[model samples]
Target: MNEELAELAASGATALVSAMGTDLWQEAKGLMIRVLGRARGSRHNELTVALDRASTAARGAVDARAVDYWTEALSRLLDRDPDLAQDVMALASLRIPERPGNVVQLISATDSAEAFAVQYGSQHFASGPKSRERGERP
Candidate 1:
């Protein structure tokens, strides 16, 4: 599973759950089904029932439990078909309307002057982050 894709799924789930109680609920559902691609016959009926039940439970509240459930659901779906990410983002953006921005950070430190590094994402570090703090690139 791709970390970036997982993050995307989480974000999309938050937006989808948030939109559940809005006038755009049907639109969101349609987008999700479209992402599913094979939502037809019994599968489609099952998804419709599940989505309706979730919407009723949400009832205009940003429920944490609902968000968590949808996050895992979307994560699993994306795991199966990563190509659906673009469609998921389309639905998410429609509801969330986020500003386009991202942040990258890296840190390095340890006790006893030990050589250690703590980092996430793609960041190159020198032998010590001290050089990085001084605007040196590794």
Candidate 2:
């Protein structure tokens, strides 16, 4: 697995901790740990497939809030690297939307690290209050 991809996966999991709640966040974190562990011995394609499945399972078991966070992060990832749009689409399909209309769509997207940062920042701002009030400051 590419180091960058590994980092992204880890960061995505961390982001989920806030985007979703602690319970779901812990699940996401577990998935990331599995991914990271397998990555040490697997190839890129293998890691990708594992991540896709993990994301799918996580999405299915959580609320739309989790899916939304995953989708937004994935959308920004695709946007920054159009080459990854297919991967994003694949992962999106694995996601089982708690709400039928919560699926994210990516078409001819371009990658922008700055855009990802902005989107993530906004999401953090929106979800932070609830997390703080609940005393889950991870």
Inter-residue clash pairs, candidate 2? 79-110, 79-111, 80-111, 80-112, 81-111
- For model 2, the stretches where C-alpha displacement exceeds 4 angstroms are 1-61, 95-138
Candidate 1 clashes: the total is: 0
Which numbered prediction scores highest in TM-score against the true structure?
1
The CA lDDT at 137 in model 1 is: 38
Alpha-carbon RMSD, candidate 2 = 20.8
Q: Which ten residues in a row have the lowest lDDT in candidate 2?
A: 112-121
lDDT over C-alpha atoms for residue 77 of model 1:
75
lDDT of 2 by residue, 92-114 (tens): 23332233444464445233212
Q: Backbone collision count in every prediction?
A: 0, 5
Candidate 1 TM-score over all chains jointly? 0.58
Model 1, range 11-81, lDDT digits (tens) per residue? Answer: 88888887776777778877877876642333446656677687567375578987887787777777777
